[model samples]
Target: MESSSAAQSVVETWSAEATSLAGAFRVVARHHPDDIAVKDEENVLGYRELDDLSDRIAARLRARGAVDGQLVGVVIDRSVSTPAALLGVLKAGCAYVPLDPAYPESRLRHAVGDCALEIVVGDPKTVDQCGLGALRVVDPGAGHDGGAPPAGEIEADASAYVIYTSGSTGLPKGCVVSHGNVLALLRHTLPLFDVGPADRWTLFHSACFDFSVWELWGALLTGATAVCVPAETARAPEEFLDLLERERVTVLSQVPSAFRALCRMAGAAAPDLSLRYVVFGGESLDLDLVGEFVRHTAPRPPVMVNMYGITETTVHSTIRFLTGQDLDGKGTAPVGRPLPHVVISLRDRDMRPVPAGEAGEMYIAGEGVAKGYLNRPELTAERFLTLDTDDGPRRFYRTGDLGRETESGELEYLGRNDQQVKVRGFRIEPGEIETALRDHPTVRDAAVIAHDSAQGATLLACVVLRDGEPGRPAEAALRRHLATRLPAHMVPRRFAFLDDLPLTLSGKLDRNALLGLAGAGRNGRP
Candidate 1:
């Protein structure tokens, strides 16, 4: 009866805070103002301080003409200030666009221009480097004169944030997610994790990545402490373990590759840590790594949860908790069941539901689905669909990912239907890498494909040079050229020079043929 009463209280809190992300955080702040809300290596912010700082930042943004429905770009690095900017944007009822300061200027410009972003909040140096003349730049951490701003009267459907993702057209598209979408996601995940103010979640993912949404907001909204993991620490397993231990992190979200690195560093014994939940997402979870992790950890190791999701469907759509038996030298673990309110449908080419156990494109329908790609109605219509269901016309987002339902009704992810690939937990489009390669003067044509080996998948680029285009460029030089235009993950690890790209009889680039060649090149097959 006591447990039932506690469950009822949790339900009531979720229901009351379901209106908006900001509102939910506000509720927590009001209830627990003195509690530590967020902590980074540089600083720690209490709930009251976070609320007060964000309110001041919002007041400053409003003074500078920021209004509801406007999109604000945040080009700051990972820190406590980042969340302040995000919450401030919400306080002004504007959607905040997260931009990594490390991203190429060209890519940044495209995202800023695509959204017609007027105001960007960041450090003064980073803001200046953005090079948007018309952009109104503000340092959210700068001192404010007037009192705290009034809380925004934001509606549930208002745009909360826009996260740009790789597009097949060699550009990034912004997915405008609503406050209600985020609320729904938190609603489903909180109960699953049994999260509360006592938990400490790590913000291990980049601010631009969708996973950070779950990390940052998930903590603040639930009155939990969010500990920021430094970029260098996140990449280095020893440092990450130290930070996790020092912070006493209870919830840790990581990609399979990174977790494997951590396990390799930790060896046979699990370090004494307070981790209760270790969630995996962003890429396919390796069963071998999962098995190794289970063996290395203590008898009551952290519960491993695999979440399958996309940017279009907010951060997560489905989740599966893994047990030691689930990783008993079997195939891949299923992505588990859909969130309570979410509807998952496996549809064929004709948009008809496929039979049980058959592969089909996964379609997500529910509150977590985004409003659509910003300013790209045609593409939005192509991906986000409205299908007739038994109840009525329901909206769905085509994930472009292939999956099959298991006997237990869990979704097992198949590969994508397109050139999109996940390398080191980052979703990358081969077209983007190909486009960058084509930009080089020595390269006439280029095709990029992911090559999988014992060390996992690495990108390989096939290049065709222009006639008499100077001396053949060194692979190192070509990589340097791509580095200026693309992120490290998107850059090809190996390059193969080809006289011409293989083409299908349909006159399209034959990706399968290219993959075969890439595999042979990787294996030193002549």
Candidate 2:
């Protein structure tokens, strides 16, 4: 926790003025009552209208027994009503837990039951399907009388929301983030993008993902317009592009895989876009794709930023503004420097800071770190660490992501520690192989995975070829091409051609599904 001048400056200069989500949003709503706040394809809600709807919903929630520090389940799709429900939950002095209507009944039941939720604000039919008959379901669009109480005030440390992430053990764990955590993230990020009332942001990710927390709050709190992308359109890159153009979206954020698909859909010519900044997150960004995108675009398309973040650390931790030079020379694009008021440490297995350019586990500390997992104290204790530094006692979240610091103090991401593979006694990172596969002229997208079965550990390469390309590459041809740059053992032993790789709800590569596709048994044995 030794203080760098940059880190110290961040701590000294920045402090959140907003105490609650509803409180901060009210300031914007009052300032720009006539500006459009939330919109979808069919409907638009001005700032005043959205605020009034949320206030009404808050009154309903209070009547049903919601109180300060309680959990309120929000089970709505990506519509204008969704933001109203979220803000309504906060106004009721409760933390909103997003329950996607598209999720399975079993997962939704587990989320509600595990949290002991008593009230849900969403579509009534979806609530019934989830078997939440005992709990009260308040529709976001319901009418209410004019006797709504004043929006309650909340402490900075009170939980704002709970987002569940899939755990290694099969069950999902909820991350509890405070209002101050999100306010700090918004304060640091909005300035970087120069967000304002004139900007329009697209909520492209699912409500359950932490990325949506940034997408939604960053726009609403800034008095900017937040456009909701439909579920069907979000799945198709071509359709997504059309939505962006039609909405005149200025600030956009997408997973690297999804952006790569957009580039493929456009081919060599970049469409005229109104975007000013396009942020890539939720997965490793392939520099090859970055180069491809730059090639198709005009002299200057949008400012491309690669950000690395974890749900435990709010949404984003680092931000790097990528340039043409980054596209020209790189293995993987750097994740950029730490955000203001954030500290990054690369520590080895012994908990000692690693020397420069050596890979180690990343530990993030400062304003962005979350409170901890909801009901898993043991897991929280293991991941969240407290260390004494010259500045003071600092709490750090172990990211489990291995990375090294560059000479310029930026972080270069290596693959995940668990993803490091040992094949034929040689340690290999699948990202490097994936990078190699992407360099091939015929390949458009690629994923490399390691599978261990009765036949022993083998590397598998799954790829999608470019349109108008001939049949899939032969296994021998791919292996031969890989051998030119990689060691024999690092080359994949088997290859599978797929039209596209499976992605998780967050749009990251679904390695578990890839393992299953590779013919590995449930226990990882053939």
Candidate 3:
């Protein structure tokens, strides 16, 4: 076996030569032509086969008059075609804008109009259902005349994709990521692991979420297999666990809330798994539940890593490996050091660096920083600023997340600055209260949201109880449990019991949905 350092050196050497994502994938395909590149329920494709299919896709796009740097919309389901369509778009020198078919018609319409998309590649049925009939649609499954792809060299700075994230103004904003940005992320991060062509990775996230960017490219660029998980299988814990075990997946990435359900099922079933890495992202992880999971895994557990990142700064920024010792301490969740090409600094509202152990907004500056939000120049200018550094000057994206550095030099996520709510003159972070609630033996998961009534704003907690528990804990008892760990004012005023918390399509906590549920007061009491 090669030494870890030697493996890392090899990865670094080859990755440095890569310019565009499609170009890098072509290099891998040339070397491992017969290797499995992707697989779905209906089809299995080898590297060379997928390459040829994508070339045809590029040929079709060129025939449709797509020019370099133009935006092409992709409205497809999660399957073998998804990767081919995305790769085809990039290979044709056009950036892809993923439009999930599941999104509402209005949201889809907004994305289409905002991007000024002229052509879309999608399943005919899905395109019709999404009401995108105005734009020309190219079916990925349709047959095309065999022809060589357009000959051209794509620049590293060229846009690869535009991912739309929810905006505070009740609309969606797109972030433009370039080929170099993604290459930098892979070059710095992939060398840390011992992955090879034999490994199988799961594409569990939707194409719309930035997490899928990591999942898809991480496998393809490294000559590994990407097993496309069906939408229904991804939502069902039991089915997802079976798929992992049956497929012998090696690398699994999930949002913390989604993993909690899988962990619970795994604790009971104890199915044999082949996972080497279980990466957590998309939300704050509950360390108490992590401890429980570690204990259940016993003698040997997969390397569980909690990654803190934002869509604008690629998929990952800081990474912390979770060990038993980390759970033994009372310290907050640590999101570890930055990736090799990334720089992280915590600063106050005035852009001054805060003292160590003091909470401040996180500002990221590095090769992985994206080009900026699409078409919204004012918003982009406000969020992405250039700061003077010892190295002269560098651009940084101001992340609204709050964090503090520990004495050990690792970052501990303190929750989002916007999530802080004030109740009766006391500013409270609901994450702290939710953490306290999860620490209780009977509580499995918890979400706290501020609800405003005619009288005033108050904190309401929606909780999921652990399985096999005798009965629901009284509201007063739950409150007393929280009182011991939190300040009196931080305790929630209303308590609600839920079978499971509402989650967005990206597997994140739906705060808006939670607030609505709290208002309904289903199985809740003051």
Candidate 4:
């Protein structure tokens, strides 16, 4: 009887929470109908307009045979219509899959086929390109959602959205996110960042990137304005900074590489601006770059948050807020404690809990845990395993990242275990070497991968230089740079200059491609 009561309570609480988020959307629209809800370079939509447009889009998609629980794909860049399509899909009781407009046709099809997408909602070009049954997401006028369809009561486990993961081996796989996961995340993030109806955010990251999950829902669901930075602008940091200043963007997110470029632009040409929140993800945080940002833009330091997680966990699993005092001893801040509804833990290979300060595989569980990889049940079973903890049948996602729980409850990332190298019986994580190489002033981006050589085993560093920098920083200079920051064995044996580092479709460094290039250029033992 007690167990039954507990289960009933859990169900009731989550059901109420899900409805609360959807209910907020209507309230925000009614209260601040004229407020800017979303702005891309091409268009700016008011809250009232978006609410009505989404309804029409939902109605149109419904007309096109889109049904509840159906998988819908939207192919577009960062734009106002983007959010409208998202709202429409959800209102129609279906999960939406975001596709990058810039991805190659092959990759686009791979995502569509994998998700079994039925209708497409986008411009004519992408609609035909997506090759789904429907051509586009129908745009509805303001103050409408396809006949004010009743917002269905959603269970904690119902699919909320599906984001494609750029698979290392084959085609990309979609990670299923539940409504509960998103709502839990929004509850923590909205208050944590202090975003409200009046705030305006610069949507810098690509829609397909998981970070956009935060940039989009973090605002629309809360009634805050989301300003979409154009692809052309985001591709060029100097241009993006200028547009951001004029747009009055209050929140922005970028990768470390992009942030470095923005700092460079600030040094060359300063933009008049007022930004309150600056967030970063998709890679490790570089304290040096953060320092540069502070030096150039002083007085009120925009809140710098380093978030960590992958597509599977929705948007973020951990975040570290960098303050002036925290920068004293460390070159970089730790990935902070898990948000509410999330539990981050360190575990040994056998899934047993490890003591704090001991490096082990990182596991995350709670409301943020995803529904596993779509259509890949076996893979899901392997990665998202059940934990027999005191919490009872808790689903923990094996992040594959090796992390040590700090004495302060933060997580210190130690790199991937499987990628750890065994050279003459010594385990080495290339991440340590890569991080060291990035310390070099001239290096803008760096990647270190283990390679086999005639001389037994070795590692190589491929680095991209900052523009206007002197001839490639010598390998000796790079080696000396690493020696100072890392142990001798963790230093790379060879360093090469890359005009541009190859990135995966998802924008993360393509390690496999790096290895392939290294293998072709030099003889490395695998």
Candidate 5:
């Protein structure tokens, strides 16, 4: 490993073992067949049971005409059946597309249509809700969901899964994750976390979100138990704590939003548990919020990590841990260094590496970088691109995120560069405007959406009223309020009142839908 700067710590990278996702599961099954691999309140399955069910699912898929290179859809909740459905698809040699059972019909239909999925595996009890025909369905009633040989010696480059992310341009596209990418991620991360057979990982993320990709399979790869938390209970404060204590959870990862919710059960209701590790991702974490949680939880776990990554680079790339001392004085925690087999580079517009401490687009190149998007070659080229860093020809993903390296050599988060607003022949980031709005006394959550009309685009602010908001402020007064904090051009042109901002299935702000509503109002259609 070579240093990019004299002050920064350099991480080493080298070739390591990589294999198909299913192959990783077999290692656990062989070593810990009786260890509880997955569990929900109603059901539980050990490594042997999970592996056999996956084999049966694969056999069922093969019986119904599934083949490699084809895609199969799995519509289910976070349950024992999920791993089996995923394994079956992989075992049958086709990539599995996971669909949240609760997704809006239109969104679910999009993946089905785009992937041309024919065989769907789910619980027969709830298959009616999916309402798709021209496809064969496999449910829990199907016999012998286990006992088939592993798909032998498959290439690491095979498509392991296809995850669809909300498209900023308004068309959701599926990013194809390869076996090599996942294998690389697990291999690199295993040592960082020091996970082993003694650990029990809490599957805390939604199946649709990329974090679940790590939470579900990461434990399996390391020969640890993946204790399941059903989606319903995972989000509920009281129930979630109970699950953690009851299951004896050792490893946990979730979003700041979840931590906020769990903080409600502080006193005697919170889990009477001791976790070895607790990690957070999925959204920006404010130092203030993290402080509140640490203070409330008291004797916190040793492994409190802030991780960062997107679906295009497997699940997570960087991780940083915090000790009790680190949070005593509130400060933004740095997302730690990159995992093994991965390299993080800061590059400018023309793909040239930037000097340390200069803000630029964050580029990620590594063993776990996804091959590309499914059937989206143009987008694949646009996002997953090439760069010539000092190391070598690197296949880098232009992580739309803007970041700067500190004098300490740690990467600092700046917002997104193309999340744009144009005024006076200059483009500005709306995140800056929203950050100011969120500080208003009467605002709970604020989102700014850019509207493009014949006269070009303007920013509109959507505000969720605080608990006791003083009704709606006069438009002029609102502008005056913003003027004190931001430049005149950055003031929101129109303010819309919402009890809550719309969110995607993954619990992220749905800016696309907000802009659509704004357009309808502009035309006086509402």
Candidate 6:
């Protein structure tokens, strides 16, 4: 009882002081001034150095006409400068919008114009190469005077960053996440893990993705070292594994698709490492693949955690810790429970709660919910909603994801609601068929898409066979394997064999590219 009371007091104290991200980071920097904060290939920055550098960057932005409550574009590659630039923007009282230099020029222009960016912090050479020289650019590496301006006094509700996500309208929409939202997420979730100054975390994803937000702050706020993975190393499984072994990364986060490749490499030669937690997010986890990887890790495997979240939910909403026992049963991927501060409800089309086991659209409410989409009022109104609960009126973000409560009270994630398709008056989920394909002995990875053919809308299966598997199985044989597990209408009619599935820059499956492969005459086999 005394311990419980002490925990309550700690929470209350943190709630009062840790209002904004910049403020929270300042507290950490003060405590761990000499501790390493960031480590990139080119540079290593201690907490005090990082703090001082960000202040100088903030001064540069302020001198370049950046004002409070405005959006500042950050178009830098992943490095020591990247975090400093983002922190600088927040310090200047402006939200940072990450613009990937690798993205198409048109996309960068769209984001710049959409957010009305006045000052962009990036490498001067990258700005010119990306043809963003027209905008006012502040080079983070440029020399600055010793007298740095004071950090901005920002409100807790003020926007911290704007991350752009692919929209249904073909254009990208920015999700505005406030400083308080992020602090709430960290305050509730960090206690679950044993993170500390000695730990090392990887910034594996691009800054454009919200997962990077968690990776960056998850380390800085906790005084852990944020290891910046280079683009080339991130693409190569062997090199990335080498990095993990060399850096002694303790908390590793990955999307399942990318991790699958690494698992295959680990099967051949397991590297010596000190990974404490392997957190999976960005996509659904394939239990069979992860189970195999766990077996290979042997005596002391890292704690495997699967997290379900979206860009609008400030990185993560649900958390589940996995074990060998979880894989023993009929392989099921459960995303566990919501964070203490988050509230999740599975609702039907009418916004009413569904029965315990029935699948429904997920509604997430709490401090983790983003403010809303930037410059998209109508769409924001449609997605972000208010409803009356037992606790009174509360605002919730209607996650288009489909999920159901398990017998254990944990949430089981079904695919996206929009991914559900109707063909010949029968509703089907492509993920169901994909899972069936993956269950086959020879198939390593599988993706199923509904294709509009000359006949009608039919399902197309794209598969990657196991490396040492005999010759490719015939389409009919694959169909027979799926038929035993799925209904007749659910089995895919056509198949496409690929050496590897296409993936986006962020490592998620590239659905559009998969659809293109399905439609291509040479790839599809009836």
lDDT of 4 by residue, 1-526 (tens): 0123322332334344455334446656776789888887778889888887877777777767887778888776667888888877777677888877677778778887888776777776556654543434443332344455445654556676888775656767789887778777776555566556656777767767878878887776666789887777776777888987788787888777567667778767756667777888877777777776776667755778888887777788887888777655435557787876688878998889987689989888877888899999888999998888876878899988888877777887777777888766678877777666666777777878777777667777877777877544366677777778777777777666776677654456778888877777642213
- What are the models' TM-scores? 0.80, 0.93, 0.96, 0.88, 0.85, 0.96
- The reply for model 5, stretches above 4 Å from the true place, is 1-18, 145-147, 264-271, 323-332, 423-426, 437-446, 451-485, 491-502, 513-526
Give the C-alpha miss distance for residue 305 in model 2, angstroms: 0.6
| Clash totals, every prediction | 0, 0, 0, 7, 3, 0
Name the lDDT value of residue 153 in candidate 4.
Answer: 54
Q: Which model, 3 or 5, shows the larger lDDT?
A: 3
In the range 66-184, model 5's lDDT, one tens digit per residue, is: 77767888876777788778877887788888888787778888888888888888876565676664467887437964345345755789998899987777778999999888877
Better of 1 and 5 by lDDT: 1
Candidate with best TM-score: 3
Poorly placed runs, candidate 1 (over 4 Å)? 1-11, 132-134, 146-148, 268-270, 419-523
lDDT of each: 0.80, 0.83, 0.86, 0.73, 0.73, 0.86
Write one digit per residue (lDDT tens) for candidate 1, span 203-232: 888878888899898888767899988877
Write the number of the candidate with greater lDDT, choosing between 1 and 4. 1
Q: RMSD in Å for candidate 3, one decimal?
A: 1.9
Off by over 4 Å in 6: 1-16, 145-147
Q: Between prediction 2 and prediction 5, which has the larger lDDT? A: 2
Q: Compared with the true structure, what per-residue lDDT tens digits does model 3 show for residues 5-92?
A: 5336535545665688888888788878999999998899999999988998888888888889999999968799999999999998
Per-residue lDDT tens digits for candidate 6, residues 1-526, read: 0123322333344456667777777778887899999989979999999998898988888888887888999996879999999998888888999999889999999999899887899998898888888889889988784445555457889999999999998999999999989988887877677667778999999999888988999888777899999999998999999999899999899998889888988888777878888999988888887788777777667888899999898999999888668877544479999988899999999999899999999999998999999999999999999988889988999999999998989999998999988877799988888888888888888888887888788888888888976434557788788889988889877788887888998889999998787677435654
Which residue pairs overlap in candidate 4's backbone? Answer: 52-143, 52-144, 55-145, 56-140, 452-524, 452-525, 453-525
Candidate 3: segments with Cα more than 4 A from true spot: 1-17, 330-332, 470-472
